[model samples]
Target: MMPSATRTDARESGVIGLGFATLWRGIREQPRLFALAASGACLYTLTGVASSIVLGEATERIVLPAVRDGHADWPAVAVAAAVIVGVGALRALGMFVRRLAGGTVVFRVQGHYRHRVTRQYLRLPLSWHQRHSTGTLLSNANADVEAAWNPLMPLPFAVGALIMLVTALALLFATDPVLALIGLVVFPTFGWVNLWYGRRVWPLYAGVQRLRGEVSAVAHESFDGALVVKALGREEEETDRFRVHAEELRDAMIRAGRLRGLFDPLMESLPNLGILLVLIVGAVRIRSGAIDVGQLVRVAYLFTLLAFPLRAFGWVFGDLPRAVVGYQRVEAVLTAPSEEPQGTRNLTGPGPAALRLAAVSYAYPDASPDGTAALPGTAAPAGTASPDGASQDDAAGPSARSERPVLSEVSVEVAPGSIVAITGRTGAGKSTLAGMLARLVDPTDGAVLLDGVDLRDLAPGEVSRAVALVPQQAFLFDDTVRANITLGLDVSTEAVWAALRSAQADRFVAALPAGLDTHVGERGTSLSGGQRQRVCLARALVRAPRLLVLDDATASVDPRVEGAILAGLRENAGASTVVVVAQRRSTIALADEVVHLDAGRVIGCGRHVDLLASSPRYAALLTAYEQAARAAGTDAMPDPDLATEAVS
Candidate 1:
């Protein structure tokens, strides 16, 4: 849902400017089609004008003269009828052309805007995505785009209405100026009624659009969390919540309908009233001998013709405000600043991948200066210099003051082809560190280096190619096992098997009914937690990234399976550097070095034994890990207090 302030701004930003700009862009996109449609509209209007003129001429020349002379001019009457028939046929053809071209324009415009919005979603950063819900974004691409272009559907009719009204009024005045003067009152009245209607309806329509987004959001949440809702027996609560939003949407739509209903009747009646007024005035003028019966009849026919154009004019004005609001919403997404800035440099030379964090620190936008909790791993101890010997104060200046740092003034380096383990309590910023290593996000302060080049300096694609990060939650598309593992890579089946084997996932996959061809359900729901983790691990392994950062990726796997996976990684350690965010001692035992974090600050970094001897915090943390593991019936450490006793 759009913020109230944003919606207010959209409403205030003159609909004509945005609406015309949107129309102009659509025209520019398909100039030939738009031009053809406009020409058809012109042709259709002129044909209608011609038909009316032919009717007036037929009445004046043949019908009226024959009636006065008391003798039927059959030949002249037949010629006039034939001329009317010909004009009617031309008008029908013009209508056909106008409708065909107008429909094509509507489709093209809707498609063009939808495509642009979808592309913008892809280009936007994860941070931006975090701020908006999936349902709102979907509505922006689909419903909003549809609403924005809806005015185009009746565009040809509206354009022709303007032409018809102007031409018809000019002819009416020429035939009987006194009747034309009274008929013209309808135009100003129609304008005033619509102007009043638009103001009243704009807010209601905007509210309806907003409520639509809210309804979509609620539905999406309910569906996505179906399992949780059912398991927790919260279905009634969820249903009630959805019902509230639906009722609000219903109320908004009904209110908008009522306003439209009132306006439509007024618009329809006003034209009929004009026709009546014209008849009364035309009769008076006819008695005064200022105009003939044929002229009076023609002027009345022209007023009757105003009905179609006037209603179309009302439709155009009535729908314009909603279209403008929808377009502004779409434009907001298209014009938002890209979160991922392009980098100019490339990562060329490399052995495995040398990783470095130089004074790297990050903070959430709302974090407090006094160091309330921030995004895990972004805060640093106050006044501490980075591991690479850079000061945090120098690296992050005034801009950093507003942010609550998640990782603070911390730096660490891992040599090529080495395994380093990161361990911290929940919210210790373990995952944030892994994210920075993979360049999923940039540090608010300092830099992350790959092969001695700042990660930000390398193109995003280059960084992606060099680093593979398997987050704590393993997500898989609903695709075949082989496709999930390969993920569009041009790797051989043998390579795939090797990667699966390394992640300890091959045996189960081979046993499946279709082997590698078996489909994994959304997020791999058909698989057990361990199976899903292994599949995700295989996905990363198959890429053969120079640097692999695993954020507790193997937590669900059996200890024996995790050990095998770690051994496999160790065997290939010479070709790649491995960074594991681990809590299990079995996993940490395999790492050549250990980095322990406390409250987003790196308190110690060394080999496990070295840390146990020198850092009391490391030993205490290890004891906590052992106790938790024992409680969970998985004791990777046989001696829980050994490290603590050694330190003492």
Candidate 2:
């Protein structure tokens, strides 16, 4: 569904130059579509020209004779009627072919563009995804692509108008060059008018498109947060906000509509001015015997037919500027560089996965406007700047002067078949560390290794298979529970059930009316928070990943359910390497080893009890977690043996 050639940007070459080039490219991409449309246009022009010629002859030969002789030749009359009918049938056939061709072209173009956009989304880096909204992406994929066809629909008809104009001028010149010249004068005037209209209209169209994206995004957000809004009783406020946006959109569209309404009537009338001038001059010519009555009648009829074509021509001129803007927007998404590059190869061996991060560091692109600082807490040191005065990592302020590093030149290791829990305060870069392991973003320096191979060396799919992530917010597709659990895998029902059991989701899933076949709804809205978390856990377990990373994935589940899930994981997935970024002390205490993180540095790494004894930071974190749990009364301490066995 992609057009091969894009519309040209007219700013550089002037409107006509760029518009024609862009059109030529679009036609070139789908030659068959263009050919079919062009062929139909040719037939349409031929039908008009033929009708004019036959009707003109009919006026002179038969009508005049009938008025004088009082009887008509029956056979000649039948022949003329039959020929007109035949020409009309051919014109109808041309229309049918063009309709089919135009539809196919438009459908294919939309499909191709959507596919390209989806592929781009998949290839882009995690950082890029962080900056875009679901609604903006949705509009580009659905609405804008469809709107693109409006400008294209009238293109073939305009071609037909051009052919008609040429043929009419030729006929007019033969009858009288002066009249021909008068008709030709409209062409340049039409060009100038279109130029003026295009300049004023394109910017307005772009503004409308931008506003449409924003409005769509807002609507999507509001819909997603409907429950929250209702809970807070903010519906009236939300309604007022939406009304403001709706009013803005209405105003923009009205401005565009006003321009169209003004220009369209004027364009239609301009052609009639040519007709009037031609007729005035023709009247003199006819009296001087320079042209006949039949020729004058034909010329007037031709101009009458031209009135409709002129309106279509005006539409084309009115929309070209907007179409170009739309094209450029779509092209920008298509042409943007992928936030992450594709790796060349994949890990070959199959065994327990081991993860190692060696001297890793990262920085944001815009943390410092002067290009000399790092993001807050991400700087290496005050004097630790590159030769260009930029920090190794980004800092928030004017220089590489942040007090702490986001991620220092630190090293860590997770052995095969181990469970390592990571604990940190809210903004301590724990999520960043997990992201590096998942290869969502590559390290700024050093490397992450899976079973002795650098992550960058592994193919994306291979890495996906090797590592599975369960983020804090788990997403479920709108499908049956079974489908969401297995995703794209071809695992048997028994295997799916086994994974669900292991993730402690089977109990609730079995209680549902449809069991595994129950619908999850959009993002699993039908499910409770705990149910959704369990389902996500089942999804990750179904993959049987060598490395499983959970970034506070069970935060919403009740303590008993969370503990049950952890126990199930230990029992069912004994040899898998597990990494958990946790806020709850019980979960961290259950892991074989605990890594205490603060200000993006690993302050302690050892068995939880050992770290509590050896590292004051570890003790403080555990104390804080316990105090919070006590304050919230989430749950009393479970069997102490549960924590001991998790560490054992």
Candidate 3:
């Protein structure tokens, strides 16, 4: 959770600072373009005022005089006509340039912010990602960014309105101070109406934006779980859930619309009222000989000219609040602190890398109120907080006094070129230890080292090159099998084939119509569970990592295939260290040594036979593994005593 002061600052700054920050960024991104756009807007405003002045002069000095004198002032008429045409053409040009430049600025700003948000997403840790949904993040990058910049689209027009208002007011006062005084009432009244509308509509618009994200999240979950919904005949339930959010969004929009509906009439009517007031004052002034009829006509025209620009004033103020809210939402994601400090040391000369965990302990971050801290593959009801009043995804702060450590004060070491099996019962920290050795999550208490250097001290890329972790669940992109295996690596086809052969995946892959070129559907949905696991194994093998950690990576495969894969790895054991987290006796039989874990503590370490002889917990866990393998109808289940004696 963010500190109360920080959150309050965000909300307070959101009212104005966020909008200006966006404007500043736009200016910084394209200073020359923004300047040109502002210039064009000013020119457009000037032209509009010039048109009003031309009309006033034509009515006063030329048309009225021509009628009274019974002869046309052809020169004056011609000059007025030329002026009108020139100003109109220039106004059109100004509109074009303003739009072109303003649009360039808006789009460039949108794109830059989108790129920054995505980069931030990538830089954030997986734990951070778990707290946010895919739908919410997507909305942040797209809809929120669009809403934040909505004011920019009308910004130039609003600027023009300001300039036109100033110029027209100056001209009006010059014609008749009394009429100008009446006309000025419209400016403040127009502002008041907008202020009223803004205060009403801003909260509604904020609700609408939040509901939009909720609606998107629900829809995304439905689509991603479409198969489950259909299979379980829960389509109607999903539809009802979607309908609830949609209705909320609809109601919010309608409320905002009603407020705008009331405000629009007032905004439009105030300027017309000012025009009437100005005309009445002008009529009185003319009769008293305080101003000429021509001057009175000019005053009328200026007041009338204000009508259009005043409407633009309403638009700017009305949209301003919503844009501010949107910008604040986007800023939250961009400003989140990254998970861990980066390292500067690089790995060198890594052959069969050594690995160690020194007094390591880990605990999941305190859960968020919304259950965001739940482990991957576990589902918690929305809006539910843990007993400790923390979200499932919340990281325990450095100053937190107590922790529920997943691996408590446990230490282990693997020599170069050794195959070590880590065995544990469910929730016994097998997977957690694998994650630490692979550097997926840092320990809460101690350090992980590779080749005598703390893993935290190694550069990010160094860790990637030195270790590969193939998790239980395999994820492949929607690309060719070859592409998924190589993943932009500059590996040759031969190396790819060799890796596939080592994982026992080449035979199945070769049978496909395009062989390595065959495209796998998203998440490898087109492949069988075992095939997907094998492909994932191949992906890791192609990297030829110095340290390979497999967390039940072959669980979906048959025992025969698992045995073959293990044998292949053992044949090349000198090239890399292997750490296998297993619950299968067949897999355990291949390890040079075994570390038995129970309830987050390492109970024993030795060859399988020695552990069985020494540790009762180790014996019980191995016996359970054998019984489960037999129940699953595995082709080969180890003979109980024979397995113990073979290691001996």
Best of the two (1, 2) by TM-score: 2
How do these models rank on TM-score, best leading? Answer: 2, 3, 1
**Quality of model 1 by C-alpha lDDT:** 0.77
Put down candidate 3 lDDT per residue, 296-410, tens digits, no spaces: 7767766666777677667766777677666766777888887766789987785898888899987766654444322211123243322222222222332231445667888
C-alpha TM-scores of all predictions: 0.86, 0.88, 0.87
Where does model 3 exceed 4 Å of error?
1-18, 65-79, 286-305, 369-403, 632-648
**Number of clashing residue pairs in every model?**
12, 14, 8
Candidate 1: tens digits of C-alpha lDDT, residues 480-587: 999998889999999999989999999999999898999988879889988999999999989988999998888778888999999988888987899998877778
The runs of at least 3 residues in candidate 1 whose Cα sits more than 4 Å from the true structure, single-residue gaps closed, are 1-13, 61-82, 367-404, 486-494, 513-517, 613-616, 632-648
Give me the displacement of residue 176 in model 2, in angstroms.
Answer: 2.9
Candidate 2 residue-wise lDDT at 511: 95
lDDT of 2: 0.71
- Winner on TM-score between 1 and 3 is 3
Winning model by TM-score: 2
Candidate 3 lands at a TM-score of 0.87
Q: Give all candidate RMSDs, comma-separated.
A: 6.6, 6.9, 5.4
As a whole number from 0 to 100, the lDDT of residue 422 in candidate 2 is 85
What is each predicted model's overall lDDT from 0 to 1? Answer: 0.77, 0.71, 0.77
